[model samples]
Target chain A: MMPGSLRAACVAVLRRDLLLAWRRRGDIALPVLYALIVTTLFPFALGPNDDLLARVAGGVVLVTVLLAMLLAFDALFRPDLEDGSLEQLMLAPQPLALLLGMKILAHWVSTALPLIVIAPILASMLHLPAHANAVLVLALLVATPLLSLLGSVLVALTAGTRRSGMLLALMLLPLCVPVVIFAAGAVSAAQEGLPWIAPIAWLGAALALMLILAPLACAAALRIAIDA
Target chain B: MTAENSPSALLAARDLTFLRQDEPVFGPLDFALRAGEVVLVEGDNGSGKTTLMRVVVGLLHADEGTLYLDGAPLDRDLARGRLLFLAHHLGLKADLSPLENLRIAIGLYGCREAITPQQALHTVGLQGYEHEPVRQLSAGQKKRSALARLLLVPADIWLLDEPFANLDREGIALVNRLIERHVAEGGAAMVTSHGAVTFLHGEPRRLRLSA
Candidate 1:
């Protein structure tokens, strides 16, 4: 059994990662800035048709946030792997999955939390209706953690490989389809004045399932990467 | 030191064999480490010395063998708290100061005797440079920073890979002194080094792996 309390270990890992991310504020801002820029470009690309922008805004924002998350995912384990901190983590008395889960939580806080905070502004800029705004935020709230969890598995799998960014994207995109579909479906339902709760619930369910399975899978993949 | 001179083996490997890509890398090796002892793994370049340490640390799985900790089959959860492995990589983040790094390290795998990060840095001769980013430190300093974990963390077994590399004469002597103190205090250390290490306490037992 692990020596210390699991809660304490998880908290320590989470706090340490957050502090490290705080020190490198510029790196934390990259994904949020990327999301903002990507959201802003949609209006120009589709010629400022408010209806068109609103119609696509839900899907567009989810896609851009995912893309931004992808940018952050590639570096999730890279720094730890390069600097040998990952090996120490493996040696921790706590379970590797627990530690990895904490890292994923910190990633969401640093990368996705800001995006969630700014998402309403992006929604308004896209002419998304006020009714759908709450649904949009809710969908993203459930979906981003799922994305971080799933993305962590992929990142762990590709942790030690050279030039893994493109490889990570390829491995992650197909797995992310369900999140995108469910998240966008919820917003689309809200846009059409239909009940949006079902899709959001589905997103939550997927997040729950991933919460159980992803950390263990990511830990196994991390072992493989380190051994390789 | 209550367990000093105890014959009971703290760590043991039986017929331990590891393979890479369907071929045996190192094979069917047997060794035992007891409390209050130091074992130097003597091997030439690419003789799987590092791999052996990695296997012991659970970073790599053994293809054909059993490892025992305290006479039972090794379980990672139990082994982790009792074992500390310092691999070839120093494991220090370049962006973080030595103090920050030590705090995280101690928080994750706690020490038996609680000592602050500052004290650990001072123990490693990094007193004045506690707040400087590790990237700014020389190779020897970085290695010393990593070595501080041995002092700060509480573990019975130490698997050190090239602990003497990149150290000045004084730094090498420092490592020797630390290992001597650790072994004398009922801890066992297994170290792999290209250069000969002159132990301050006594000569370390040898385990040679041939490629």
Candidate 2:
């Protein structure tokens, strides 16, 4: 038997996922729309005061993006799990962790990247100061992938469970706390004119750590989840 | 049941037992699948055939006993790319065209020499439907799209669970032809079916599991 090429397998996994996301482009739009709607609702509910909106804008956008990502995260592995594509991926000659990492990368691209692309607009909508808005974007840039990496493991762990959406959120809350803290801390520090690089650095460190570990964890979790 | 334990068998298992919640799904089972052979895992619904396939594919671990690949302890790393498994779930992305799906399979499994994805699709009787999304194809057509992988990927062992489930008479014949060609080319296949349809000629080996 010819040994499968890791490069070819990685490209295949990435292309398959991206193509699937394109075919059902509505799904990619869902989280973006959700983020938009949630960001739009804040000023209305919190009253039209610029000071109030600016003060709360960074935190609100961070939480909204977090919740929006959570909304889209359940799908990271569910479709593949149901369709047995994931099984094929597992049996492929390449390391399952590497394939899963590609999947997480694709998921981040389809779901979180869109949200991040619109973050500046979202932040501006809530009257976030321009400097703090840049920090918010920077924070999300490092943070969303961190959330995606963390969320993927939880999603894989709950994969075999029925209606795992709520269970996913509950299980992820504790893990997401640190991510949220660091991200929001960065934005708020920028707002207060304090150096925000420390919190951004923390999130980057965590993202770098999860960048190596989450896929490995997710692969093991999926293997265990599908054991029945 | 017979356990030939051929020294040159490409794949063999000894006393393989799997437990579901600590209750044995199959116990102390033994079999050897040599190259250029076809083994039919015949059993009723819930007879652990699919579970056995999944176990051999390394998705599920056996509670007890060992699996050997080429007379050595089955190392999953080494066994991959050598075993091809086609389960009830065809694994074709419903949204992708069959050609694209086949390309992904070839990309992951590595292509058999000289066989293009288009040629494989045409060989599987999916020529005109090559660009049709798998979701729109009939159930039988979806199965054929998956069967095309057998032609495009270079796996020495094929584990096909319920290969006949969604096929018409012609599709069944196509499967037999594929298996015969695979075995003729020195590859082996283990097919599981519970129905009473006629199988490949030459009295292929049967491994039965009682529910």
Best by TM-score: 2
Q: Give me the candidate number with maximum lDDT.
A: 2
lDDT of prediction 2: 0.90
Per-residue C-alpha lDDT of model 1 across residues B81-153, encoded as one tens digit per residue: 8888888888888888888777777777875566666787788789899999999999999999999988888
Clashing pairs in 2: none
Segments in model 2 whose C-alpha atoms lie over 4 Å from true places: A1-3, B1-4
For model 1, the superposed segments whose C-alpha errors exceed 4 Å read: A1-4, B1-7, B195-201
Where does the lowest 10-residue lDDT sum fall in candidate 1 chain B? B1-10
- Scored by lDDT, model 1 comes in at 0.86
Q: Work out the TM-score per prediction.
A: 0.94, 0.98
Residue pairs in clash, model 1: none
